[model samples]
Target: MDPLTPMITTNPFDDDKLREECGIFGVSGADTASAIVALGLHALQHRGQEAAGITSWDGHDFHTHRAMGHVAGNFDRDEVIRGLPGGSACGHVRYSTTGETSLRNVQPLYAELNSGGFAVAHNGNISNAMKVRRELIRRGSIFQSTSDTEVIIHLVATSSYRTLLDKFIDALKQVEGAYSLIVMTPEGMIACRDPLGIRPLVMGKLGDTIMFASETVAFDVVGAEYIRSIDPGELVIVTNSGEIRSHRPFGEVHPRPCIFEHVYFSRPDSIVDGSSVYSVRKAIGAQLAIENPVEADYVIPVPDSGVPAAIGYAQESGIPFELGIIRSHYIGRTFIQPGDKVRHLGVKLKHNANRALIQGKKIVLIDDSIVRGTTSLKIVQMMREAGAAEVHMRIASPPTKHSCFYGVDTPERTKLLAHKLDVGGMQDFIHADSLSFISIDGLYKALGEAKRADGRPQYCDACFTGDYPTTLTDQDDVVVTNQLELLAERVA
Candidate 1:
């Protein structure tokens, strides 16, 4: 297949939701390091579901295993883990936001550098990857994969710095955007986060072994003690002999971690940025209730992602909480949609309204966010079909008016419902009796802030506020290229 051509997965039911970026896990100073990394990746499966890969340095040689699917089917087998014999290993689970969904893009992307063998597992987007790629190509750097992650490897390979650590830091300095990376080399394992820290990464320990993962919840899965988050712009290196070192190659800068993790991306059980995700979500729902109270008989969640907030909303609004929608846990991720008829019935296969419970009831539906508004409209229509007297919609997060350049796979600015429509217009489009979203200030309040401060808010709320923390050099280049093409067309 052509590397430039995108291989799109058609899932009508999930298309309206923002796609997860990726997950990374690493372990050093353990005999069964690859096995432990597999367990950590299993716990972080929600972050990415399309593909998984692991790379291990077994004393003298590097061993790698990669597949296009979930961690269970590919990595759980005894034979697979035994093949990756090493004391240090790093793994990645990926959902393609910057590359095609293929085996070639599955990472823990590895290379044989002049210094030694290097493998990297990254969990974020590089905003300036294309600009750097063009420059590298001009300088005779041959790229093996179309993934932006591969750009880091090439940069490190071509750097003029004398030491591997300095070369790694040099490569990082040229890139823009979020990254939480776990890198494995012959000498040691290196874990680091980008300067602005738009993504999340945490450290943990089990006996003498040190582990790194995208979330603390991964540590819990593998029976590791939570250490702490890898600080923004900080690099932690664990040597072959268990000696550890810390470096801050990037100077001090205010961190701006992604705020959406609390709203939707992260598992509720995970702790992010020293805050419980479940607690933050519940607080967000309570804030939503205070800002948009309504007369309703029952408060219902959209299910799974919306449950914690729904409970908080019901408690705050003095309404009974009920599971008005039931989700089918048996539905497989690869369930086939034979045709348009089957595709249109996809929502029913996954979620069905509780007709008996919701009949003749005034219900309020709580959801994380509205992307295209298609899912919200269908859900509201389903509630009405179940004999709901009234259906009101409440969103836990503020309007997602802008596209995310940092890792998340969001629809374009024009495709987002909030970007094109106001609150009233969105309500009309969804056919909801009432529609409301938590104000940006209310969202911050839920996170224990009075409100969002004037400039440089506490977190990276770029998707909601259109205030990107990094320079989008790639996106800017695309805009310029498009303008040039249009001008050439006019002249022709």
Candidate 2:
């Protein structure tokens, strides 16, 4: 037989689910900062798998290692780890929510400025990046990378502040949007979240080494003791002497962190905002089951991401839980399809119907969210093929009607299935006997809220509610701005 050719297409599973943002990890005052950071980045590989980079400051010089692949592939080598000898380091795993996938855009972006050497690894988009980029260009602020993150460097360089930390604080005041930054300087490390805390960042410690990461899972990876999450607008600096200082540079404001973290982005075993991610997902399912009860023989999950919700749904509805679909662990975002025949197989490559359980059963299928309805449509058909008498689809989240601008790689709103189709239309498009999503209020209840507060929401639900917290300056001009995002690499 001819060798099964590996194919490259976004058709498989990448479109069915929401693409994740980047993950950042940093550690200071460690004997092997680079190696531990590598491990932490490896744990956060799910956040972004496109590229990985780390920058380390070893007192005498700064070392950086950036590669366009998974951390497991590149950072696993001792040779690679040995190249970065330092007592403090910051690293990032890229998923390309902003800039194109290029070596120049890979981050832990290092720049030698008037304040000495500085490196930054960031999570979340700078919504006004273009506006600032334009202003910087006019004033002769030469930028290196295409990423909005580089804008911070220019701001810092141009600031008249006396200290590096002050320059960073002044620079942050000028930018608007969600960000969780892990910045490394020769003096030590500085970590902070945006004023609204739209992205998640946590702090921890392993021995005398201080740690910072986008998620607690990174802390788990490197055996770091869990510390409190970095408060919104709070900045912490770890000095070369291992002494830590805290600063609240931004003015008082109610922080609204991203709600989607509980819905999908975070690891199930991880704890976020003092709540267990797994428990929250289960609660979401229970709420979904209560609001949308159905007569079904089995509660089946879409697998992996959907399992917790399915379990909760089963417990709440008194329906037996069954693994109706078995997912293949090998399925990845990108793979080489043999040809059109394999490409057409679609959901089968990633998931398959457990015919023995699915056959002759009326099933309620639980999924975290329906991004495009492509996978749902295919999975419903698969159940029918397996002799399922009926398939009732239950979504754990409210309808994802709007594209995310904070960092997630969401398709255009016009392309969102929920944006164009009402609930009835969505049910019909997916060809399910019945379909219902958890209400916005129901979703809030799952997160321990009585109901969603319209006046001052607990979290950013812009993707579901279209209630954006910050102004989208770079996104206002769709054509010219999107062109700038796609074509522009740097400003000089």
Candidate 3:
């Protein structure tokens, strides 16, 4: 899981279908924690694309710098980071899930409370946010942002607990959903994982320095010794004295690591616990070759995220891998745009089929996952125009039939191609010669043996299996209201 090495063994064709949320990194050390975290966040910019933010804590006060762009673009020089002046810092790169893509939703959310402390930075979604907001309003709390994460600040501020940790625990108890939070405060830095382990949080150390991040990749960037995951429902508090206290409010709940993380979200070099995301993804492609083998002259990856799996598929299926599409490195992300025309144009401008390699060849196109059918359709059309004899599409993950409220931006079920059509039906819709999705069982096997601390084996397939770990109400207004009221009173 060394970040120095990438797992991809072949060239891949980058496409628009693979989308991911951003990454987070936090550090508590002797000096320039904000600058260190900025570097760490830069290493993790691949996890998110919309925005980047950093919050630092000097002994007397907290300073934050945030902007809407890549880390390198936003925080290019040391002076930008040095200006913050804090020994404890938390940084985030955000891909919006709630509201519009504006500075308003950019994370490392800061609130200066009556407690004379600054609370900043949180990750993941609150399914009960609408309910929580309602509750906060009933108690006279005003919200300045549309993000669900703001509820956490209000909750912590209003809690009756005497200590900050106790207040956080109480605030968390009232909300339900996926979250892996890193909070920077005057007292210290706190890291916590959700009860279901739906998102990842890991802790690492470099001598007296303590670091936390959404992925282990950050540890690699900061030269910190890799520590294991922060366990489902576990909380670790690092104080000014460097004493670390770990708490498990929800002990050993069956961990359901977000399957999508392994499939497409996390860095290929990051090892989640003992699991190698790269190896698991390759296994997924290999397993796809076994269960859903197709006849094609060559195998092609959808690029960037799709390469490793495509290599495994090619190796297992006895097909040679080739770069059938060349992705334009200069183009901005396909999903980021001011209008539908721009977004659509981005897809075509970003990828151009290699007519020399693709012409008159039976092509097996492998991709991570498909959300809306639009991107796939355009891609298929691209391959066809390039004179492909036949295009057989292979997906490395199970069909996504449900929306992800936990932060990955997926459309509603009806908009999902697999939700309405089976493999055969999807083939017709996308004009592919054939189509196959890796089985859920195959996805599990590819991820390698799953072993729970209690000796059970399981995973979260909520997007595909619809087995949500927590229940969020359908009454959106009521849910946000209740959560808001409860959080406001608890924090106030």
- Count clashing residue pairs per candidate: 0, 3, 33
User: How does each model score on lDDT?
Assistant: 0.90, 0.88, 0.78
Report the lDDT tens digits of candidate 3 across residue range 401-462.
87666656566567788789887888898899988898887887786654222223376677
What 10-residue stretch in candidate 1 is worst by lDDT? 1-10
Q: Which consecutive 10 residues in model 3 have the weakest lDDT in total?
A: 1-10
lDDT of 1 by residue, 1-492 (tens): 112322233465677888667999999999888999999999999898888999988889989999988999899999999999989999999875434456877899999999999999998888888888889999999988888888999999999999999999999999999899999988899999999888999999999999999999899998999989899999999999999999998988889899998899999999998899999999999999999999999999998899999999999999999999999987766777558767767778788999999999999999999999988988999999999999999999999999988888787789899999999999999999999999999999999999998887889999999999989898888889999999999999
Cα displacement (angstroms), candidate 3, residue 336, comes to 9.8
Q: Give the better candidate number (1 or 2) by TM-score.
A: 1
lDDT of 2 by residue, 1-492 (tens): 000111122435556788666899999999989999999998899888878999998898999999987898889999988999989999999775332357888888999997689899989888888889889999998877678889999999999999888889999999988899999887889999998999999999999999999899999988899899999999999999999999998879788899999999899988888889999999999999999999999999998899999999999999999999999989765677557666658678889999999899999999999988888999999999999999999999999999877887787788789999999999999999999999999999999999989788989999999999998876775567677977776542
* Candidate 2, position 101, lDDT: 55
Identify the leading candidate in terms of TM-score: 1
Q: List the candidates' TM-scores in order.
A: 0.97, 0.94, 0.89
**CA shift at 438, candidate 2, in angstroms?**
0.6
Relative to the true structure, candidate 2 reaches a TM of 0.94
lDDT of 2 at 305: 94
* Number of residue pairs clashing in candidate 2, backbone atoms closer than 3 angstroms, sequence gap of 3 or more or interchain: 3
Candidate 1 ranges beyond 4 A from true positions? 1-9, 97-100
Q: Model 1 scores what on Cα lDDT?
A: 0.90
